[model samples]
Target: MAGPQRNNHKRPFGNSQKRTFGNSQKRSFGNSRHDQTNKKPKHGRQQMREIKRMGRRHQNEEAKEDFPDFPENDEGYESGDNIGEEPSGAMSLENNPRQAYDALMVLLDNGKDEKKTTKKSEKNTAKVQVIDGNIPGNEDEETEYGIEDIDEDEESVKKEDEEDQNDLSEDEEDEEDDEASSDPFEYHFANPQESILENFEQQVSKDSTLKWQSTKTSTSDKQYMAIGQSAPIEEQLSKGKQNIRLDGNLEQFKIKSRMNIPFDDANITNSQKLILDSVFKYKDVVFPYQHYKDESSIRDLYAAHAVNHIYKTRDRILKNNLKLSTYKEALEQGKASVEDEPELRDQSFNRPKVLILLPTRQACFAVGEKIIEISGLQTVENKKRFYAQYYSDDKVPEYKSNDFKYLFDGNSNDFFCLGMKFTRKTLKFYSAFNQSDIILASPLGLKAILEKKEKNKNNKDFLSSIEVFVVDQANSLQYQNWGNVSYILKHLNTIPENYSEDLDFSRIRMWAINNQFKYLRQNLVFGKFSTPEMNNLIGNKHSLNLSGKVKFKRNFTSDESGIGQIVFKLRQVFNRFECELPVNDPNARFNYFKTNIVPFLKEQSDDKEGGGALVYLPDYSDYLRVKNYLRYETSVNFCSLDEYSSQSKLTKYRDGFAKGKYKVMLYTERLHHYNRFEIKGVRNVVFYKCPSDETYYSEILLRFLGDSMMRDVIKDINLSVVKIMYSKWDANLLEKIVGTQRVPVLCFGSNEIYEFK
Candidate 1:
């Protein structure tokens, strides 16, 4: 019996070729087996096969129910071919080979169909879970399948991962671009000309008041009137013809209405008005006679001057930028040509233009407060942090003198530096130096930064464009470190290095480009008293202000000098030394002291009645040289004291010298300046050089020689002798210590020595 009328049909597996299954070969539980008379069934095996077929049939029925829309005969088999029929007999493989082969093919088809049904069910379930916002687990399916199915799944998963990574990288790149664009330092300027033009346009559009329309006459058009004379009033009165008429001419010297003084007219004293006027004119000014009472007014005046300068500079640049922008816009619109473009060169190498050198943090705070007041800004960006750093609530000590109390009050901590940026409505403190409009720093602070840059061979570009330089409390700086201030001045207004990309070259001023900024820069120095150092600094080549310079003159009489303050009746001797060249003055003075004064001091130390000589040297270098000479070259028992001497060493040396253990004591003026030690048991006093601060000279004599305790112990104040050494270079110091009239006789007289009692 030929395999009962075979029904031919084809079914597709994955992507491979299709396979044909006849009705006798259909792999379903309900399919009927062919009736084979020549075949015999194995009863035990047939029973197990029947049970497995039944299980598969049940699973297919459930799959059909879950997806009722799926076609029942989609696998190319008749629906009736596998429904409601049982096997008639089991075919024996040894008796009927064709029948057994058909059975094996039927099993393979059934396995493929079951896999397809299960996959469809699982895929549909996953779709439902995803639509419900439930993520599927990463577990692999255990169902056996062809190799093609596994490869397809892996490719799909890899493509999804690649897409996810690309999306994440794109997002990160976008965030970085935004950050780079927002940060001014990191932002790369593609077209600086256009960028600055736009910036200027925005500034003007936001604040209409920035564009000033004034009818006041320009300073250039006004007649130049001498505000005040530098000569002493007595001398000016002596020459009656040269005396300035003060009748109605005072109005000409009055501050111009257009000068924009921040304080009220009544608040400013009459004495400060002329100084303010001179400063407003951008002239170099030296007010060495400034008193503590005048500090506030001086600070206010300079703050206003600095603010006005910044305003004018900003206005000029913005106005020029607007003009350039308009011209370019017109050209783009075909209404103007290249020749019609405006010339707008008004920038410098960097933005900082005002430099305020203060001695201490307290002074910086005062000046910064005045600047903020003058700016009329309601908000300061870092005001809280700035106050915490510069302001102090510490109680001041009860000093013996009011001057000392005032000088030491508040946060006197030095080594501070800060940069300020000004805007239309606000002021920002602690800005980067390169981006700041003003710099407030101590000399030491600036020196430290300069030294760091020097090691790297980098130029100080921030200081290259300074236009207004103010040094307040300059005398105080002399006490701290004058070399720091000198170093700062030497590096000002120099050409920058490797900073070309940071600036708009087309808009740089011709003067700045040619390194002629020093000529236009204004130098203002204020102090309590004048010194030779201050005079030399102001008169030096660095202070070449094109607007002219003025200095206040002070004259002194014998009674007004510090020498007259000495209480003890003792003989005072002045010795003059000659030096041919100014550069060789140090060596000449050292030699003269070594040859002439050292022997006198040695003899005094050897005398039992004379006691130890207290030798005072002003310059630290001189102190060091004298110290080394006395310690190594001389056999005299000596003790040295300086600013660097610690408390233990100071105590030990003071005790040793007072008890006559040491025959000589070498003292430095700086040590006395910082700590006014009232040393006991001092007899002969010798000055290696006149002190820069004349007060120190009187203080030492009064405290050491006129001490009541020492007087009672010694009982012979007249035996104490004071000797001083000087030179033509010390003329300024000598004039301040001994009256101005006496300086002429002492420095220029034929006598090399003068005696006074």
Candidate 2:
């Protein structure tokens, strides 16, 4: 029956071919054709069976969305047969059993999701962004499969994180490029030496007023201007830079001043121009003398010559046609006898446009004439004109300090002070006394008159009208017998005794004094030596700190209420020949005389430059000691301070040295102040002891060189300074003498020349 049944199942066409379904695969159509075993290999059937088992096992495990890598059905096999379809031909599976087996393996490698979701129904994929946190839409909100799904999700998240990191790196790179372009540090200076010379050639020298040879460079620290370096004054002024053209009427001449002269019209140096520009801008300025002469220092030039330019220019522009206008106002008000002139209205002040405060009558007269000359108003026709008035304590007749009550209450300006009695002067000065445009008055004159003048309405006439205020040689002013500058500033600002609507109010700058006046805005201060005492006038704690960067030289804070500051750049144009000799030996006295002290003396004595030397000791005891030491030990010949009997002799001695009459001039630093005589032709300024007041030490050195105002009288020879330092104190003082703020000590060798490290 089995055989018949086997026969009943149509035999497969290929021998040894077996086709089965559902546990019936043991039935085999058998034929042993050896060469062609014409039957499916046992291993092929085993591989198919293993694949089926694997499929079953995979079905039991959970399915996930994203897997790493897997094989594809297309790579495995290409079977033309489909499951559950009618058989196309008898099963001849032996033809290609290996390909069939591979297809089954492919099926087992991949699986269907447990909870079937359609392609369209599955969660939407989104672009992953590495925000502060993971993207909200797809990270936590999306549908997920199971445990394996979680693993796949984590891998996908890592890939997204890596991509986000790459994007962030790119953004950081862009930011870095922007920062590199934005913040930069480079430095430059506005005024170089070459630029200054070029400017001089183009503007300063070419101008009609200052027609010199465009400033020639000299090989030495001090420059020599042979007798006729600059063109003759007459030639420079023959064709005046500006023609005087004033309105014929005095009323038109006094048409509310509006100064319009450009800076180009003035004959001044660039440094002076800078100062004038600052003054016009209403800023206070300070000029520091380097304690010695240098090419950069223009303090004296600005003080004496440049200020004149400002005054002259202001007047020339505002009162144009000055040469055209005669004194018609004075003519209308007929002049009478001295007794019949208007009863002296004492203390009456016509607003002085520019106030120049000086220490001595000599300077006042000299500087007053200079201002007039520079104004181009010196001579109507070769005769000096009355431009600025000069008054002094000595020139004013002597008056008992307490006899003011007996004196007539006549206006001081109306009368010339003669023999301690007030008497009206020539009528030509009638308008001058009442109203001079420029005032060059001694501080003592102002101090004495203001003190005794009945403090009525016109007490502060000079100060009230001042537009520009300057104190030339302020060190001299404070050292001599004038009231302290602080007191002057305080008194100037103080409201006058009888200030009222009727009083002639001076024109104050609108920017300085506003409608809702809080304080003066643009009042300016000019000082050659800016002493610490100035702080009291401009507000104490708010004063500039010299220990820090000065007001003008560097970045400094000066936004206080009162005045503006003008600070000059202190520079070294020439190398200082510093001699840093150590004088602190145990045999200090004799060693000093033998090595430096006596040698320096002999060198000055033999120098044929017609220039003498100054020997400065710190105190009287040191002076005497050095004086005796020089005479007894070194045979050095020098003039001592005690030899002078009176001021006249002191003056003679000073002049004689300047004239080369003496080789050596010795004095204590005390005598430098007491015996104040202008000495020039100084070959060497020697220091035996360190200066107690270092600032004043600089002033003493300045005395050796003459100001442009007094240049004609000076020797105009080259200068050298020496110091015989004995101790650490001397070394520190030596540092100050070199005129540097940063380096405390300078290196100098036996050759007596500065060494740069």
Candidate 3:
């Protein structure tokens, strides 16, 4: 039978080969021959077998659901494979031998009648296991043969968990339902709670509408009762009326007082009363000076000026057919471009400082104004400008201890001291007051405290720190005065009781040596002079000693001319002074010397434009150029209008009287910044100097003084010309060179000349 079976299997004519059990051999469960052959190679088959064995080891582990589809497939069998294919195929027997053998065993164990079908079913079971464990669903197939059955088990488990959860939830729900339905009223009735009793009373009051009580009186008693009850009430009412009348009287009195007017025998209008009330209510509120002046009755003097500003703005709007708001806005926007006003000079403020010695209160105020003005000056305007303000105790009005303190911070970094040539009496008084309680009460304003700050560290903070000495008892007088800073000065016993040889008290001698000339001089001292060692130290520190940047003229040889004496004096008087001006350029050096240094130097040369013989007016133009170079007014736009006019237009003109010559022609220096005093109708250029100081003063009502030749020469010019001089004021020399006129001379330091004429 086996031989015949083999022969029949090999032959196509055999019954087994020819016959089919429901087309079992021909049906492939839709899998093609190519698919089965390519299913797994020998190495892949071994890997798969190992994978299967490992999987069998974890069979007892709960079957995890298919991982959510990730779009990747690892199984050898791809999509479109028919599941009906059995292990009878040679490819399957090679891929998974164990699975094939199991299928064969199942077929063999079963009777021959079911052998073919049983083998197919076993193969299908193997495929299903791989699919369940590793493979994802077939998107085209929709449903698998055993997946529904597996899902049924999952559903039953899920249902069991949900039923258990429902049981717990039902119990909790039953308890909550009972608690919510419990009778709160029963607990209230069980105990006599105070809140509960109150609730009952409140409820009764809310619900009941009928009255609970009533009272009646006889006719005779009613009449007596009315009289007794109403009498006191009427009296009290009368008292209240009287009190209201008194209050009105008091209010009226207050209104009159606040208005600064007496209401006695005067008719007070309702409007005036209302105004008085409003003013009095907030009278204690502090306001700015401008606001205070506005609220007071004194601002009417400038009504016309204010009206002019308004009229100008209104005219702009009417001419432009624009809104008042728009015109005002434009005016405000344009204000920064206007030229600065000279009148604004009066409103200036100075850096907070202790006022040591000043000429007068008016002078102090003037200095304060100057300081404030300089403080607000444009950086370009401030270049090469040094301003000083000095005040004497005499200038200060009589006041309490804290009065001066109010002028400065208690711990201010700014200090004022005895200037270069202060009177001895003034110096001593200031030095004594500097150490007094009135000045020392607040450390804030003290020079010592100010010196601690970075900005003021190098400034002279002590009287002993100054190199120049003030003359004491030069024209000594025992004039005793009280109620000024002198009041505190008198109490100080710091002055020496006995004279010493080392201490110098030759005030008159030094004064005569410094100024050996006959002339009335306005006292003013500026800049510094240094001793030889001090000069060398500063020069070395600045690298100026070794530098070849500056070359002094060789005319003043061997220290014989007055130039050497001036240099020696300068070196002796000042220490550690640094030059901010450029000394390398001849013109610049000459200008610096003429404006600052030459003023102090003794007359040395008569030659024109050499050895300080002729002074050069600092061209404000150069300063403007430098200022422009320094980017002081970066926002200003400058345009040359030479095509149509010789003038140049500047969007803004930074102020401070400055002029300079380009080559030979003098030109006004524009700030390249907005002006504060400029109005549309007013000329930007004003007060061009007249020919002579006398003529100039005659025109502007200003005091004039200077050499007649220089004055006469500059009189006709429309530009403000500042004269430069290097000679010490001497009456004989003045009459010989210029005129016999007694000119008002402004002296700077010991040897410098500065005259407005």
Candidate 4:
């Protein structure tokens, strides 16, 4: 085997191989001789390494031919795996060492030449793109690279192709947009609205089939909200007191319940009696369910309903000169009467007519059989004359049929002036003098006549029973002379000029009177049934006095007592009368129950000392229930003075404020003690309680005063001194203003600190 292998090697090298072996042996022999001579080995190891590198390069060339990504004959040094570099040289196997080296250098030069061409092309492309307003990629970068690098050319071409494709896609998008705009909706379509509507309807039908219930109504009837139908006043009252603990502190108030007023305490009036009776009679009955299940709430809806009807009736009566028939009714009656006479062509009954003329609200709303009796009159021409005749009729029974036309031409312009003055005086008397304490109808002369008529009813001689005479003919303002009255009267028979104004002022009296008479045949008078003035009157109106029939009284008892007796008797007679009081629903949940005590609690405070400062106001439903209960109790007892005697007092003080005594001592002491409280528009000092946290305390105090809505109505009210404890004072600087009151500072550790008056 050795002979064969040697022979093979010898065949390849021939005599040169043998000479090389012989030379290697001779060199070995010489090296051995030199070793003995101790000569140092020549430094040819690096040269040997270079020769081995050349051999590797040659082998790499053959490998390159089989690989596509690798270049074959570019340079002696192979290109690394890094991007963008040319090979330095190419290597070959068959050649003299020097010749091959020279060939490799030539290859390196060609690669260098090619790399420059590629770099210049890339620069030109970048410059061209930048000039065209496109972002240049690697335009400013010149990576340090060998000139002989050839591998970078392939990588550059590949990267450039990818960039070009991306740019083309972006450019193509712009072209597509232009094409679409030119072609419009050539490739798009939309369905018609009718189809969309049909779909919508289908969806709606699938979801819910019920139609929306109408919330609008043109009738004068009262409508109840669903929640109100089952809510009982008694149940609500019980709920109100259920949470009230006997040990809890009560809130102080300037105004107290009207029921707290004493009946025999001397300030009572016929109007007050009527109001009290009406309120009480219906108090327990406010919740119809209390008496009868499944009863309609329309009867007790808004408290204003009855008042509005009264106004409407008055308007109609005023407009029609006390005529009972409404315009429509008169027209129909005229047409029916004329049916017997074929040639009658007349629209004469179309004019508006008045049925009743009332000087005051209480007189119109008088709850008595007499009011009904008086209201039943069908026709009373010249309202003032009629009233005069009616009053005079008590003196002489013959005047029952007395025509008012004979005494005063029925059109005396002087009557208008007198009436105007009388109305103004009466209003002033009630508003400025009465101080809203007593009813306004018990003192009037009309009530006296009614009383006399009643007392004389059983007497054999009716003529002798007429004790009072019509001494004065108090006139009212004429139809045209009075600006305010005329303005209201003219519009009484028609709708208001504007809805917003209707929310404030009542309509002209004429329309109300006419409507009352026009709807006389109806269960409720038509004129009294509807009108813009009536709308507001029934909506949110405040009352000051009674109607013309009832009168206010100052004396508790009197010998003549005719007027007071008449009012009292009338109220007794009509105590069963019921009407709705329409009011806006309050913004709180109304719960009703008959529990022994209230049990609801919002939350408890963590602060031990200051926690007691917090309080909760009753809900509107609770308020209503409590009010009704109190009113009921008052009504049943006829608002007796004893009712309000001990626990609380609702005494009427005076119409206007009394003048201060202006005592020098008071000015120095008690008066000076007044820090700065405002009462009835005067600034006075008052000791006040303060809160722990002044900011939170103020917020809570403001709530007690009332909300913004309440404040709007209570315009004249102003606060000066709030009860404040002296203890919570954090700053000693405050002592300068408060003086030597020995107020508790923050160091005292009191519960609350309040503003001092």
Best by lDDT: 1
Worst 10 residues of 3 by lDDT: 473-482
Model 3's lDDT to the true fold? 0.20
TM-score of each: 0.63, 0.34, 0.13, 0.16
Q: Candidate 1, 256: how far from true, in Å? A: 11
Clashing pairs in 1: none
* Candidate 3 residue-wise lDDT at 210: 24
- List where candidate 3 sits over 4 angstroms from the true fold: 1-447, 452-757
Q: Model-by-model lDDT, in order?
A: 0.57, 0.33, 0.20, 0.20
Q: How many Å off is the CA of 188 in candidate 3?
A: 65
Model 3, 1-757: lDDT tens digits are 0011111111101011111111011212221323434554222222221222213223213121211221122122222211222111011111222222222222222233233455556456434432233233222121110001111123332343354344434543322111111221111111113343344335434654322121222222121010001111111212221111101221322111111122322444322222222122111000111111121221111111112222222222222322323455666888533343211111001111122222122222333333322222222111111111122122112221121222211111111222111110111111122221111111111222222222222222222111111111100000001111222222222222233232323221221222211110111111111112111212212111000111111111223212122211111111011223334333443344334533232222111221111111122333334334323533222221100011112111111111111101112211110011111111111111111111111211111112222335223323223332222222222221122232224112433333332
Clashes of 4: 89
Candidate with maximal TM-score: 1
User: Model 2, which residues run further than 4 Å from truth?
Assistant: 1-268, 288-350, 360-362, 365-437, 453-467, 478-484, 504-666, 669-736, 739-742, 746-757
How does residue 743 of candidate 2 score in lDDT? 25
Alpha carbon lDDT at 592, candidate 2: 60
Error of 1 at 324 (Å): 3.9
